[model samples]
Target: MKKSIYAAMLSGIVCPGSGQIWLGKKLLGWGFISVSVVCILVIMDQIISRAQVIAEQILAGNIGNDLTSIYAAVSNVALDASNSTMPALTWIFIVNWGLSVASAFWFGAQQDKQLQLQADSKTEA
Candidate 1:
């Protein structure tokens, strides 16, 4: 019982779909991994590129270029990007993360039930 909860929590909170993988749900786990990879790569690349641009803006002394200014600029840019493919990417990320977490917990439950059924069958036999 404790192990099941721990595994589910770990999968949901830490790796998302890892619990499913632990339960031998390889297809779901790998699907999660692939989708997550794409979303994460896009988000990380965006962050790094934006950070570099912010740094350059600071170097160029644009609009005082303080942390607050940088934040505002980032928000504005993200908002602008929302009108493009950025929102789609962001939604993909959101949906994938949510699915991963849900899959982890759900697969954990399914695995536990499967084990219970097998144990009962063996006992009856």
Candidate 2:
């Protein structure tokens, strides 16, 4: 059980679904991995778009054509990007990854316990 848990946790480090795979839960692991990948890609796209918008704004002189305005605009972009994608997606990834590892461990442990109980019952019988 410990070995399974360790493997699952290790897999999570590589990708969210990896740990689930280690525990023989291929479908669950794949689901988690797919969701994580999609969320990450979406986050990246949003960040890139925000950066491009900021750049265009700078180029267009809409930010006062001054260093201070440029700095402020950059900061605003950073904040917006963080709010738009980073925080929410990061939380989702973390939760899914954690759940995958925890589920793998719990499943393995429960199976082991059940087998042990069955063996004890047979011995007693």
Candidate 3:
């Protein structure tokens, strides 16, 4: 029982659906992993685009002597999305994480119940 809970916690915290996969649900775990990968890619794209823009600004003019200040300037407006994607992406990430945690606890509980039932059956026999 404790082992299952801990397994769920470790995997869920690491990759949300990973706990489910560890518990024997490959498809569910892979789905969660894929969505997470997509989210990471999207976030990385945003960061890279912002970095490119900052690099362009640096090259176009004498905007700074300190690179740190330039980084700060770039970071401030890095979240300016072309559309309403930032909020959606944020929600997707949150929902995925929440789902993962919930699934972990649920699977752990199911495992505990199964073990209890098996032990009871053995005692009766």
Candidate 4:
């Protein structure tokens, strides 16, 4: 029920930086979102490029048109490290998400503490 919990869940389950946005930290949230989006785009670009290569092979008759042949080609392409930058991108994406979640939770907790202090001061007055 705490804002910190909600913020963390938003970032972890919804998307990176979503929690920061919920916590009114627009700039930080956007930074996390931008990094995540860029990583995703780059990864997708690599995948599409590999798909194109497979398609070309199919067209050139080097790969069969059957489902099994297509699967084999896809597997080969995915495992071909020389043709992909996915390994590093995947790690970056994961680390970004983790940082976003942690920051959102920390910011949310800080906000909650401030609110509590304000409330206590008002009660003392």
Candidate 5:
């Protein structure tokens, strides 16, 4: 397979920035990795905190232990407007993944072109 295609696939399938790392773009790859990690951490923290709150309510008898009650609590948490960070983090993670894929493909294609040029020059000489 072409390096560009492979790199793009790796980035998309594995983790964002993995393709860039495969393409020897350590700085760019690490940058994407860091952003992705931060987004993931923040989103997870928000979700876990909400879950803990619901669990506490259930234990305290504020919320019933029934499935319906649990579902409603989850729904309320999902629709909560005060926690807008989750949506923003999700979008940022998605955008970062896309950018990493594109960057890996572009850099790989450039490398391929350079190699082709070198091969052509050698053949001429």
Candidate 6:
């Protein structure tokens, strides 16, 4: 059980939400995947929109000698998007992955304990 939990943690580290799948929880696995997808899409949209705006400005000749400043501002916006969303998603992944691993261990330990109790009762009989 410990081994399985550790394996699930490793899987999650490699790919977000894979730990739930490893633990045989398809619904949770899919939920995690969907949330990740939505986050990525939102971040991508922000980045693309900002970039397009910068490009349009450059094409319209508004980016005169201050092109460097314009570039810097656009870069800042991109980084801000990452700063806002990436950390949140990363933390979410870490927490969920850890919970999945712990749950696997707990489930196995409970089953083993129950079996041990049953065996002990039979011996007493």
Alpha-carbon TM-score of each model against the true structure? 0.72, 0.70, 0.84, 0.94, 0.95, 0.57
TM-score of model 2 vs. true structure: 0.70
RMSD of each: 2.9, 4.0, 2.2, 1.2, 1.0, 5.1
Segments of candidate 1 deviating more than 4 angstroms? 2-7, 65-72, 81-83
- Top TM-score hit: 5
Per model, state how many residue pairs clash. Answer: 0, 0, 0, 0, 0, 0
Off by over 4 Å in 6: 4-8, 65-67, 75-125
Residue 78, candidate 2: how far off, in angstroms? Answer: 3.1
Q: Candidate 4 residues 1-125, lDDT tens each?
A: 78899999999999999999999999999999999999999999888888998999999999999999999989987788684468888999999999999999999999899989999999999
Q: What lDDT tens digits, residue by residue, belong to model 3 across residues 31-117?
A: 888888898789778768877777777787745748787967776666556657767887898788778777777877788789889
Q: In candidate 5, which residue pairs clash?
A: none
Write the candidate numbers in order of decreasing TM-score: 5, 4, 3, 1, 2, 6
Tens-digit lDDT track of model 5 for 1-125 = 77888888988999889998998998999999999999999898888999999999999999999999999999998998987788889999999999999998999899888988999999999
- Per-residue CA lDDT of model 2 for 21-110, tens digit only, reads 776788988998898898889888977887788778778877677878878887877766436457878899889888877777776677
Tens digits of per-residue lDDT, candidate 1, 1-125, equal 63367656766677766766777778888787788788889878877887788778778988465778878877776666444555677898778877777767776777778888999999999
lDDT of 4: 0.93
Task: Give one digit per residue, the lDDT tens place, for model 6 in 17-122.
Answer: 5655665666866676676667677766766887787778777877643868786767766677545665676666567556655655554455557778899999
Model 1 C-alpha RMSD to native: 2.9
Candidate with more favorable, higher TM-score: 3 or 4:
4
Pick the winner on TM-score between candidates 2 and 5. 5
lDDT of 3 at 70: 91
